[model samples]
Target chain A: MTKQTPLALWRRPTFWPVALLALLWLLNAALTPNFARIEVRDGRLFGSLIDVIHRGAPVMLLAVGMTLVIAMRGIDLSVGSVMAMAGAVAAQLIAVHDAPLAVVVAVPLVVAAAAGLWNGLLVTLAGMQPIVATLILLVAGRGVAQLITGGQITTFERPAFQFLGTGALLGVPFTLWLVAGVTLLVGALLRLTPLGLYVESIGGNERAARLAGVRVRAIKVAGYVLTGLCAGLAGLIATADIKAADVSNCGLYIELDAILAVVLGGTSLSGGRARMVGALAGALIMQTLTTTMLMRGIGQEYALVIKAVVALLVCLIYTPRFRGALQRLVGREVHAA
Target chain B: MSLLRRNIPLLASVAVYAALYVGASLAYHHFCSLRVLINLFEENAPLGLTAVGMTFVILAGGIDLSVGSVMALCSIVIAVLIEQHGWHPLAALALALGLSTLLGTGMGCIIHYLQIAPFIVTLAGMFFARGLALIISVEPVPIRAAGHAWLGGLGIPLTGQLDIPITALVFLGALFVAAYVTVLTPIGRSVYALGGDEEAALLMGLRIGRTKVFVYTVSGFCSGLAGVLFTLYQSAGNPSAGVGMELDAIAAVVVGGTLLTGGVGGVCGTLIGVLIFGTIQTAIIFDGRLSSWWTRVAIGTLLLLFVLLQRALTSATGRRKAQHVSG
Candidate 1:
């Protein structure tokens, strides 16, 4: 592949989501004082923008995986529940079992991936619709998490976990680096291997993909597994940040936000063709919106309304019929002029 | 036998509901009386109404994640109008229902005209309604109007200690209307046709947009009614009420033997599903040893079972169709 110039990169489809993020930040800069200012405190950068990255990391990670699963024409509604379950599992290990940090982290992720395997198998083997199959876990996952914690919030005090949430590398937040590392790793796997192609093929036409000898079931299942892994990591970060795992509220409504990010990134809900960078920018946009709302002293409740409006606008802009109508209106104005 | 097999999901749910109720009644000795039956309907009125509405949406190959939030919004609106402001209870109810219907219409128009996915649009509607409700008030609002008391007092006494609630009557009435619409009305046929094949329905010159909007309107109206029933039953409206009720409603619909893929079920099945759901809750309550979380697990497991049942029926039909065409 030829290297893309900066202009060429901006011309690509991934540009709009980033452009929207930049526009949001610019609007915030006008509203709040020092909104764009990045200060170095204790050798770490501090600002609303940096704070956005830190707060946005979990969603960004979710979007990274969601972009792929959605590209495979499947959705994981259970991500929020999986986050609760993962957090519960990790917290139980840390607080009760007195496990090693690595073990605490690794075990939850494996469990989360197994949950994904269950969703995938339902879809592939039983021929359940992806939405229906995932909905089962979405409903039951939180209950399972609550059961794990004995119907109580589980709190843990692990220095290693806290450091994972707070520690920085060369003035950057650890979560930012974590998001970057996971994105890069997933990006490499998608780009280097046949996984990306297989996803697009199955999403575009499953029968055609099967006729072409693609491992449709395995690939589709792998997509969900990857998503679970990402959600698991997100769970770890969120739990570590709070130092507690509240099964009921951990990662609540996050799957919706992740899906919104994917849609804003210009990925069609009908599936096919994953947008990696677009999803990252979409996550940034959501975080920026939230941060800006807080800065403006707007109540947190209003953020939902604003986010919904913005997502609707993004969806409308992506709608072919809406675009055509806009074009016709513009064409009429040009002719009149 | 074929007919029984074809209606296997409905039969299975009925069987499950019956067995659970019977088993619990035998074990607890206080679960099978007329009082418990009346109480079950009263308690599950909100969920039952939501499930009926959800049935319409799902039968049209659409999903409405907004029902839960819409119900809360409706309850909040009525609470604020009746308590905070001086509006009459009946007037507030009408206004809330109208507002919710308008919200549903907007969502349906967006989904149909702008060609957005129903889930995405309704999810937005969910947040929109929830945020609006939160903006109104986060605190629980009690309905204390004189008229509300009168309405609440109008219950039919079955025995000295047992009576049927107005909420239960409203739910049953709504269920009757929904069953009629889905089974008898031409509009209902259009819904099934649209769900079965949108392209084919369009080719057949069905009023697709109107039917789509009508489905959502029914959903919105029912959810608003559910909220009103819930407020009456509980005597208060909490903004965060029914936070995850959409899932429960959907679970009930799917468990009732209605295919989530659409075009294969009715509201009557949903009634049985709701009974199963309520029975699970009642059983857990009676056992005293089981936690409430088991209800969620039971719901999930039952949903899986029905989905598998639906899957089997769909594949069998598909196979039969293939063989017929080939022969």
Candidate 2:
């Protein structure tokens, strides 16, 4: 009898999503003109390719943190609002304090981390469900953001900040590189450390994990804190991208998009599983699809409807119940074949 | 003690309301006046009505994230029918309600038959309704008819001191109906059972599907009613009306002591929740020193607190049950 290692088992689910994304990229390149161009001038990379990478960066950041959170059988609906709030706070600091670029950047991230800690405490100590606990933030975070900005768009005249969003590294956009770095860091943490095992065990069965002496509450809190930090990072990218902090529109509906990316990447919403590479692939696929639709002159409104439909279809395909129904519909002959 | 335990949400909600009132009164000189109180109720009437309807859905172990969008759709439909087609106000109101109910029934059917998650279904419903509203009209249309104003609260005098909003009266009336249905009806009991344990309720002969459909339908009807009330109070209808109001309704419902996981809650709790939510917003304004942004922060904090309390209580009970079984 041969025993399959855990690493070997993990390889199977991870490969397919990446392969699918690759196929999508190839298809888009073949179909769309100038789809894969990356050019460098004045030490800056620029193109539709880089734009897609930058635009998708925030969501990718979110997907990274969300993957961990969801791996623990929890969802963070407040990421969008947190992003908005962080952006609002970050922009406010820049506006009010004439703070240095680094300090301006650091303040919002800290605030976001605190917000995440608050969510963690609620979930761990208060024992609230993740969805409901995060929801309080989801509902109020935006309002806090608005209040921070005095219900106005806050703009900063910082070139370095804009560069984070728009600059390049070795002809690759800074945002893309950031995504790569974060993904690698998160990937390494999940694969190289005991943290991944602990998260998985805690998610798989909390009681068993507790009995095994796992600090479940601390780990859950850490997941939320990580999520908040990521959200704050995304907020920085978002604010830098537009060169302004627009509280009302920044990071709106991002939570849904991030969740979609995670789900499409083949991560189960029902915990005990984590897929870092799949999330990267999922984020790429989402960006590619959106870019393709928009470049093809698809109306933003219709694009939304299409995205929803595709998301639903993807969910149906991935969902066990829906897959089972599909298999039953196809009958035994197909299975036998 | 059992009664009190069963009604902790109600008690907590009342306590919050009282706290808000006292806080508001101390903060603002005119806050305790009847006129100010009436004004507050009038301002929040539509939201209160929606909260009442939401109580049913949440109690049934489901959520309607589309309520705000549905209200927007209903408002748009009513506005378009009255303003564009010259339909009478009452007829437009009925048609909007009917359409909203149909939408809710369709959502119910999809959830029950397709076995789709309520979260997904309602999220889609939100988009569909919001899209339909935008498609109906891109701009806000003022409802100028005297009859429309009457429906919204144009002519009623409250003790000859201030104009009474018909929306408030309508909201109160809806609350009464919701209270009766939730507390007095077998269907309501069935809803609680469904929330508690669907399979067990099914084995006990509850018509699970029908009960769910009924609650959703009622929810839709209330949303439509809320639309009419909102349009009347605002004296206009915008395609973007009621955006994010669903969160407020959910917040109110949860704060009112209705469990998000469902089973135990009532309209009375919801009434207090809405009032508390409204008071918080009013208090933010009254404080003058606080930013309106604190309204969300305050509500968010309170929501987290209540949800945490509920979680602790439920988990404690669950632990006790586990201990009982192990022992």
Candidate 3:
């Protein structure tokens, strides 16, 4: 491997996503007064920046799981719906019965893990496409969630359950800490373990990976199960934040956003590459975009438009052809001068 | 043996549809009526149109997640033009279809020029279309135009007390044209060849770019037609309409024997697939024992089965092809 110069490094594919995130933060700071202000409010950190991470915790966690799934040449459209299902299950347990804290948390997490396992089985053993296989749950999982809630937004009145969403630790939001911990853990796993190499080898070329004695099936399955677990935790946080489980709209389109985050993080949709910190940056960028749009009195509808444009621009920037074209255009201008 | 091998997917789809329809007819007395049968097409005309369009995209080795959103945008555009802008109904309809085609072509341009994956490209397209629709109108806009009412009311009386909706006829018309183009046209053949293998098609001197762009444009046109039919059926345009419709369209195409990996499906199969979907919904509704959500579960289950079945059939066919080559 060759050591790249600073200019080359800046021109590398991974640099743009991070730069774009920083640019968005700058934009937010410029537009909103006191956007970067941090103060201890009632023994907790409170500010727009803190709010971004706190709100973005669910997506950040999802991005961590999705990075692995995409790394293995697969996608899990079921994650968003799985979040709803998990939230619904937790909400039902707490609302219907004075269920113990462990039961409420454990049941949903297990159900979500099973959902992930179902997706993994469909993709591996059944020889189905990942998009279509997970799409089955993307469509039906919400119905299952609704059934669990009996077609109602089941609300629970448990302070213990609420703590997962609203509680703080050491002047920082608990959600933020959870997200940071998960991100680091996933990052370490990818960097320090052989699992990451196995995943990349499989995604890069499955036949070659199989020839090299990699357990392609197990790795693929683990990828989805991890994603499911992440989604389940995100769902619990979401339901706890609201104290209610709205199956239909809960976690709606979060999968698309997660995929977008992964893409913006310089991870190719074709797979075989993973980026942990980049995905976190991508998630924060998305949350900041949403927050900025809302702060500017932009309708949620227009926010979708802006996000779509940003995603398209990021995707276009990541394309090698587009980059080549751009560089050639700049080179032409420089030569003419 | 050769004929059996070739027509297995089509045969399988027909068999599935027949079984579901027959079973429903036997179980529910009212399900056997012609009105009930026609109602299936009427209720699902938009889905049928969208599915037909999807078959083209998928057959060309691409997927369009934006069809549902495109349909929604078309409906919104038509409603806004007619009611809010005071434009003629026919003119508004034309403009809506034109806009949809333009959107599709734009997406294709981005995909081809940037060499991006169709899934992510179309995902962005979906958001853009849906957002634009909501921006057009957050609430449902009722079509009070006399022309729209006429269009909506246009129907043919078949038997004693049964009238066929114009929208259903329009669906059938779209299906007919799709079948004709797919079977008899050079462009359609090019689409299939491209999907079968892009490099080979390029080697064979096919118009890869034109065929790719044309398929997406055709899909956009179908979505536009579906949107118009939806508006006519409901007499209003809701921005949120056609939610999850892309999935339904994809499901119909897959169930109809079209391969998701691309290059092996037809409009005829898609038509049957749409009918199977309608039949399932009808059966569940007639049963009344299960909630409507069960339709989603049932469709998901069927989608899974059909995808697995296609995999099996394709593998068998591939094996036979290999044997032939060796022999």
* Tens digit of per-residue lDDT, candidate 3, span B1-327: 265765677788899999998999888888898888889999999999999999999999999999999999999899989999999888988999999989889888888767888899899999999999999999989999999888898889897778798999999999999998998999989989999999999999998999988888888889999899988998888889998899889988988988888888899999998998899898989998877788888888888888888888887878888999999
Off by over 4 Å in 2: A1-46, A146-152, A284-293, A296-298, A329-337, B145-147, B153-157, B161-163, B315-327
Global lDDT scores for all candidate models: 0.90, 0.83, 0.90
Candidate 2: docking tier: acceptable
Tell me the deviation in Å of residue A134 in model 3.
1.1
Each model's iRMS = 0.6, 2.2, 1.0
* Candidate 1 lDDT tens digits, B91-143: 98899999988888899999998899998999899988998999898888988
> Residue B93 CA error for candidate 2 (Å)?
2.8
TM-score-superior candidate, 2 or 3: 3
Decide which is better by DockQ, 1 or 2: 1
RMSD for all candidates, in order, please.
2.1, 3.3, 2.0
- Specify the CAPRI tier of model 3: medium
How displaced is residue A62 in candidate 1, in Å? 0.8
Name the 10 consecutive residues with the lowest summed lDDT in model 2 chain B. B149-158
Error at B135, model 1, angstroms: 0.6
lDDT over C-alpha atoms for residue B277 of model 2: 85
Whichever of 1 and 2 has more lDDT, that candidate is 1
lDDT of candidate model 3 versus the reference: 0.90
lDDT of 2 by residue, A101-150 (tens): 88988888999999899889988887777879899999889988998898
